[model samples]
Target chain A: MKRDLFIIMFISSILIFPMTVEEIFDKVDENMVYKNMKFTARMNILEYNENRELSMDIFMRDENNILIEILASSSGHTNRFMKKNDQMWLYIPNAGKAIRIKGHMLKEGFMGSDFSYEDMSENRKTNDLYNMELLSKDTLYIIKLTAKSSDAPYKMKMVYIKKDIFIPIREEIYSSSERLLKELIINEYKKIGEKYIPINILMYDKLKQNSRTEIVYEDIKMNAGIDDKYFQKSYFER
Target chain B: MKKIFLFLIIIPYIIFALRFSGEYNYNYYYYQSLNAYGENRVILNMNADKGIASFHLQGLGQFYIGGPKYIIPYPDNIPNYVIDNLPSYYQLSNSMKINTAYLSIYYLGFNLKFGKFPMKWGISQTYAPADIFSSTSPMDYSYIEEGILGFLGMYSFGDNTISFIYQDHTDYEQTKQGLLFENINNYFTASLFSAHFFNTRRIFNGFVFRTNTVEYLLSGFNIITDYWGPGIWIEIDYFADVEYWIQDSIADYSHYFLIAGVDYTFNDLLYTSLEYIYYSEGKTDGFTYNDILRRYLNDNFLISKHYLIPIIGINQGETISGEFAAMINANDLSSMIMTSLIYQPREYLSMDLNSSFVIGNLGKDFYGLPPIYTFQLKFYY
Candidate 1:
């Protein structure tokens, strides 16, 4: 009788898990659609030791998820790097010359930060890079993703999402070595342009370093037409 | 007359060009304290500087984008070009005077310069791999002395250019000689003098299917002669007594270094890079009058920091990254590794943090090198 009971419980768990996961994902996809929207995001970085804190502003739009503009404070002493399509340029006030960065040099540290030229870029395609599998349904849809890109920095990721809102609750980034490098949690969500989007994001690292980054969105506008000419690489040096 | 010529020749083009740009930046180890005998003061701070600028031609010329000039210090005891509208730290005193000029032109995919200008030739990540030969170094942030007064030129051949050059005079010296007892060698003879033949060539290729890599090679011959030496003030003698002689035993040196690196783009938002460097040793120049003065005045002061380095970095999307760098002695010196991470929320704001630790056996109770840690907050529009 005990063996029969265990078999019945296992079969029921498997049958219910897929049904709930599918229902949650269906709710999420209902909100995430291709549209034109404009939004602003703010983030704070806390460094280890007795170092100071850092902040940033991010502006994003989804035009077929094609173009994105990221204007960051380069450093305290200079202001520069407005470019598109992975090309970047920097203008130093003191030198009086605008520098053009080509190829891999753009991948370098942005002011000694972990963020790179690619990090501050417009790349949003979860399905393209990951082989997704529905794992379980707790309060949200839980999915496990395995990277398809062999050269990817992370090997695998587990994402937690809200069933009703269809927004991610948390994501853990791992190294190829499977060591947990960073964990990102969405602390707050705001409804904008008929969709629930993350308004506040917090990033923490597993390394015993006293560094954390918080991103807060203040003013968000969506689907305003912006000229394509503004996103050109030539605009960076100009 | 020269100053007016400079304004007429150099200022026109800079004023005419226009641009618009922005950047996301972070700096780790903004400030790390050193543990010492007394209350550990801010002995040294993690000095990280990052920023971005965009420019718009307004239908003027072609558009260019890249990193800006991060370090440009004002002239004090050092001598170089002065931007009239910008701030300056040094002013002419009653006892000293400084004058300098350089003609630089960047056009037609080439950067050419004649007269005094800044030029770097070497392979190094921390200390220059070709320390003995490379003129510009990481430590020389002020860019004061590296701008040799000579004919310097760089051309991009098929998107890049490599060439050989020769020059005289590493530092400007008085054209006239000083006299002792109303009769001595002329001031021009007392000036600093050096000569060199340098060859440098770099090629950037492999932009196919979103993967790019660049390779560079640098070689040079550096010769220094007739440097400033300490002398005794002889009220009665007719010639300045050369006491601390540096000229007689100085040897001309030759050095070479190579740098190779590749940057691969896995996708629009992910990138990775790896680099390798090699160096050959050569001769180093004389110590400054300050060094000799410190030795006589007190017994302890740093003379110089010279070493070799290797660096690596990786980036994921717009908010996460990692950088690992190490500098070690050519042969036996223990290595120093520094790693950092950065986070940017938006265009106008960002943050950075980094940690540095030592590897292997470092002699002494505590390594002269302290662990590096820092944080930086940035604001730019």
Candidate 2:
């Protein structure tokens, strides 16, 4: 009788630990957020039997500022994008001046890729912008997140998180009209120090025909003491 | 052609050692004038970068086919004044000139550059009062400013920068020195610039505020705001002690120019912008026709008291884009409309087709100008 009781208690503790939706989001944010990081990434865009590649260097500070520089491209090169707070600026080497990109332009695909500018610029804590609810719990924890504000790029997202590491493995993004717009699949994960990072990502645009983009991250350095000057506009002139 | 081939041969060696990229452009222009002419131009641009050092070079070749008698006039001697106003392309009836050649070095937080390069300033796209380094030509849509021969040094801090330029005009025995300070932020950017000219015969001898023979003290302020949905920009330029020759007499005056513009994008598919400009020193209804001509001869031409410009752009996809722009002269009711289409089949190759038309009554602004059509193919690697 005591063995059966112990078994029932063990099963109950495993199933009914009483984890809140907010706690799950907080755990995910804690595992994914970084103070400052620098990385080089390559994007491969595949569409209609054609493959295009672009390489870029990225620097991020806190959660609100980011600097992206295109290192090499088959097309024109030396393009830069800087995001500070809510404002974003693009500098084209030919124009030799930085132009402000308005909010509506954030939804457009970046450099003709499947990733939108908003997707590239989003560095905020997920809990700050999304309301989360537990959907199911199997080998992975499934959660549905809805944007807290209308200004968000996607209205809803269904995220599948690894139950052990609290890292997202897959996500489905929905448009404002509740239509599936894009699917993001995390292909590979690397554990650098204490953090688990998704190093390879595949994005598929459901609304488009035979269009997909793959991002591979390399030379990633976290907490590398990047200078604050890198986020300033004066550094963009080069 | 031999020199160009040799230069292309050296590019491969440089690419193996460092970062090297170049572009070749071929364009054809058709002008609808009384003497209707066609011009074909081929330009090559090469750039190399390694560590703290970089180099840029541009070469252009032009061939004129069936133009008016006056199109390529051969003179005994090319006047200094003509050379001063010559396009940076360095086109002469007999010889070709190197358009741009520059080398730059960066160390610490300072950048030092030498040789000839194109420098552009001011917030307005079309007419910028603060663009004292280059002149805008109404006949071409290329927007290629004449390169300046000079040495430039710049130092940048967090959000602030300071720059100094020493420009030399050896042929005219003159030099210009300028200092500029700028600060930039997420919402706004501002700058203050001052330039001094030496060896200008018309101005007071030593350290006079001038660019070339013209004496002027200039200051500009620009503000950009996005507190609202769309973005609004305001720019103002103040010119103090501007000297102009009126019927062989030099006169001094002060004036200010103001520009206000707003831009917006809808659904990430279309972009639109509207801008208005007001020039305090422009010829208005109060000035007679001869007075306008005198202003034109004084190096201030085609500037109206008021101007309105509207621009629209459509991005069909990654391969196609189109733009339409109209510049309206409020005083004379004249307007210039331009339509352009760009097709990019590959990442490094593109083709562009452009057409421009001018409409107004005779003797009015933009009316005497002829329509133009252009087709260009660009390849970059």
Candidate 3:
């Protein structure tokens, strides 16, 4: 009994210094936010012994703009998804039309993948819209975040952040009623310039059986000096 | 022809950024107590994108096999009086067409396009009153994208755009000019448009017998938004100065079309929506002369006053999805329910099956034709 008590006290002494939620999230922002980023990725979706693959080149500028150009598909037709200023537009090359999507539609799976448009959208500055609390401190900083804004993608999120690197290694997303919706794990990261970024990720929908999506980034470039013209509709048509 | 041939040969050498794509689609339609048909369609497209300019050329080839042919020979036995009116086998034909050929230029703040291209604009899936250019045939919806010859120009400023279009109908008197303004934002997409046709024709007994040289006006507004939890859309269109030209007498009047709807999605996997539509050109009790004439000229979906549509769609996995819909004519309680399924085993191959049930009297004004069941196989390269 005395040995057990001593072990507990020893662990407590090591935890005398603790990190604040604000400080941790500020570090997170540093690792996540960027001026311009370009990445080429391949997504593999597996369900019921069947697999589907999609190849895309994603470009992002600032917090509100992202363009996903689907490079390869079965029909060899080019399609695009662009998010600018809280609005999403889907461009079909065959139709020559850009259809504006809605909020709930953003929550649907993108191209039959496990990733939602909400998940593909650039979500930055976690400290701004979420009430953050550090849940525990050990090998990792366990944190809980409840959304403070109505337009937040998820009602609540639990983050498992790696130490020193300030990058989240895993996350559990929950709905408003506290139901677990999806679980995401970052499998690998690459040290690019001064920051560490996730390069391989896996997401599973808790509501489905034997459903999984794996996203592997083939190439990633940070602060690549991407032009604003590439984010416009005319440029997308070209 | 010589110039086009020269351009096609030389341009391929000059432009290294050219892409070629084609599709072959075969659809078989069968119905009871009606003629069965099979159609084979092939489309080939060549596209070039260089700097601020782009070009697209599409060629289509279609073959109608066993035209108006049926597997079941009429009836086993019929009275001589009924046998005299039996249907005859129709001859099959084949044709090739240049579906679309357009050149688009984007420079500074202006977007310019000239040639023959399909005009696609609408909000709702089934009934979009603002889509006055070309409409889709829901029953036989294969290779049905129609393009008109036109020149279009548009200028954009921030969140708003203004466009002008001029469509040619082989002569100056049959030309059409239009202008449109739109503002797209995070919450709502709204547009106001107007088109004026220099001349239109009159249809009688399923044929456009003569042309009327009177100006006609078509105008509309469309607004779509995501309101709180569900998506809501509303569209309104007006037709003015329509000339009937019956018995060498001119009958002029106006008509209106309206549509409003809302949709909700469940867990991002299931989609559901309900819609209500109103057509002013139709009668509440029955179809009018204006309604029948509009149906002959334009391939309008509904001919009666009120309609309600409920649709549900589900995507279970990466490769499979299905949609079921019911369009009901509120005036007579007649309805059509349809379901379509698509399966893609590979990126280059797909098979589709669609079946529908029509529940109404055989003499209804619209959607009274025998329902067509379709099985199609498509290949792409």
Who wins the lDDT comparison?
3
User: Which is the better candidate, 2 or 3, if ranked by TM-score?
Assistant: 2
What digit string (tens of lDDT, one per residue) describes model 1 on residues A1-238?
Answer: 9999999998898777645444555555545433444545544555553232334333333422233333333233323444332234455332323443443445444444444444444244565456678887767678877778643335688889886678988988776577786787889988876778777777675653566666677766666664433332222112
For all predicted structures, in order, the TM-scores are 0.40, 0.80, 0.79
Candidate 2 interface RMS: 3.3
Note the clash tally of each candidate.
68, 0, 1
lDDT of 2 by residue, A52-154 (tens): 8889988888777888888776553557898876678887544435776774467767876889888887877887788888989878889999999655667
Chain B TM-scores per candidate, in order, are 0.42, 0.77, 0.83
Q: For model 3, how does the per-residue alpha-carbon lDDT over A37-64 read when each residue is reduced to its tens digit?
A: 8989988888666787778988888777
Question: What residue pairs clash in candidate 3, if any at all?
Answer: A74-B347
lDDT of 3: 0.73
Please give the ranking of all candidate structures by DockQ, highest first, separated by commas. Answer: 2, 3, 1
* Better DockQ candidate (1, 2): 2
| Clash pairs for candidate 2 | none
Query: What TM value does the first chain of each candidate achieve?
Result: 0.69, 0.91, 0.89
User: What DockQ values do the models have?
Assistant: 0.03, 0.33, 0.26
Candidate 1, TM-score vs. the true structure? 0.40
**B219-327: candidate 2 lDDT, tens digit per residue:** 7777777657677888888776644533343555667889999988776668889999898967544433333333333336445788898989887654688989988
